[model samples]
Target: MRQRLAFALGYLRNPRHVGAIAPASRALAQAILAEVLRNDAQVLIEVGAGTGAITRALMPALDRLDRFLVIERDPGFARMLSAHFPELEVLNCCASSVDQLPLDASAPVTLVSSLPLLSMPKAEVQKCVSAMLSLMTHRPGSKLIQYTYAAPHLRPFANIPYGWRWRRVVSIWANLPPATVWSLEQTPRGASIVH
Candidate 1:
């Protein structure tokens, strides 16, 4: 109950960053967790984790992951998340700085993002998208799972990377305004390091 109120306040303060009035619904969180469980990843980084609604659901998979970094741009939300989940490595920073994190390149990474790409400023979006792509590209077998409020068929952003492809994972209508989950990954041929 308290979490809901804080999340609502967070949204009121910054509609674009918070994205939704309420935190991700139970169904939406479950859907994302299911996807995470299906894919075996060494490192799991969740970006735009507002108020940790999905973070609660992801706790179950904590045992399997070597590293779990929760990235929340909002300082208030980040502090709240850190307080709530002391076990997690919560970072208060923008999504565009993902590449700067001290991550192990040998470990496969799977980044779950809740950023509202379509509605954000284009320049910021491009920087974030490029950063995310670079992180995934450097770590072989890495993939990025992002959810958007856009149509189910839409790829999160256009420029499909060099060899990466987007696959629609699931469309969750139970959420506040509904959301579609999409994953960006290297095609089999693109899995190997080319540069």
Candidate 2:
């Protein structure tokens, strides 16, 4: 309940960033990450980690060698995440800077985003999607996971580069406003969107 209050206050402070009235329910978080496997990727990056709702869910699933990187733009939320999850490497910066992170080039990175893509400006969302794609190491199965309250058929980007594909995995109705999990995978250099 305390965490929910903090999340609500954060949302009130900046509706555009926080994006939701309450923290994500455990069920929603679980559904969003249902397909994630700790052994599939070397790095785990969670963007828009508001109050560690999804972070808490990802904690137990993470492999011992996985590098957990968290990106939170809000200073207050970042501080809270740092305090609550001392083991994680929290990066207090905008999600657009995902490509700028000092990551290992050879290691595959799996990104999980809680950002409000439907509410954010299209250009901003494009920038984030492009940056994330640019930064991912396409070692066969590297992918990105994101949940949205929008329609299940809505792809993150209408015209992405030739190598990426996104598909809706599941719709979780237990959340406050409900959401659908979208898994984006990086295929070969010339592959197109995966219907």
Candidate 3:
């Protein structure tokens, strides 16, 4: 109850930064993070990590010594994140500037974003996603995961030429307004040609 109240107050105070009123459920967050861990992604990038609810769930799912990078535009939340997860690399930056992230292309990266894409201007959201995709390692099995309360089919970047296949992985009704998980897989051109 305390956590929910804190999240509600946080969201009310800053809707743009908080994004959602309630943090994702532990079960749902774990399920999403598990998929990233399963892919053995060397680097994990989290955008809009408000209050680090997902971050809390993510840490246990990750390998003992994996590198996790979190980006939060809200200075207060960024400080909270830093205090909560001191070991992680927390950047007080926006998702749209994802390309500026200090990551290595030699390693595969899995981006987990909680940004409210449905609320943002389409062009801005597209730019951020595009930048993140560009930074991703083009390895055959690399992918990204995004969660939203809106319908999966209504996603703005559905037709983008990012060579990614977006699929709805799971839906959690137990959450405040319920949420859906969207997984993006980068399909190789050769494989697409064959199919």
* TM-score of every candidate relative to the true structure: 0.93, 0.90, 0.86
Candidate 3 stretches with Cα past 4 Å from truth are: 64-66, 137-140, 188-195
Task: Please give the ranking of all candidate structures by lDDT, highest first, separated by commas.
Answer: 1, 2, 3
Strongest candidate by TM-score: 1
Candidate 2 has a TM-score of: 0.90
Error of 3 at 11 (Å): 1.5
Candidate 1 structure quality by residue, lDDT tens digits, 1-195: 989999989888888767676788899999989988878887999999988999999999999999999999899999999999999999999999998899886678989998988767779889988998888888878998898888788778887667777878999998988989887877776365331
Clash pairs of candidate 3? none
Report the error of model 3 at residue 12, Å.
Answer: 2.1
The deviation in Å at residue 159 for candidate 2 is 1.6
In candidate 3, what are the lDDT values of residues 36-68, reduced to their tens digit?
Answer: 776777778888888788999888755643678
lDDT of each: 0.87, 0.80, 0.76
Model 2: residue 190 alpha-carbon error in angstroms:
12
Whole-structure CA lDDT of model 2: 0.80
Candidate 1 residue runs with Cα over 4 Å from true position: 189-195
Question: By lDDT, who's the top model here?
Answer: 1
lDDT minimum window of 10 residues, candidate 2: 31-40
* TM match of model 1 to true structure: 0.93
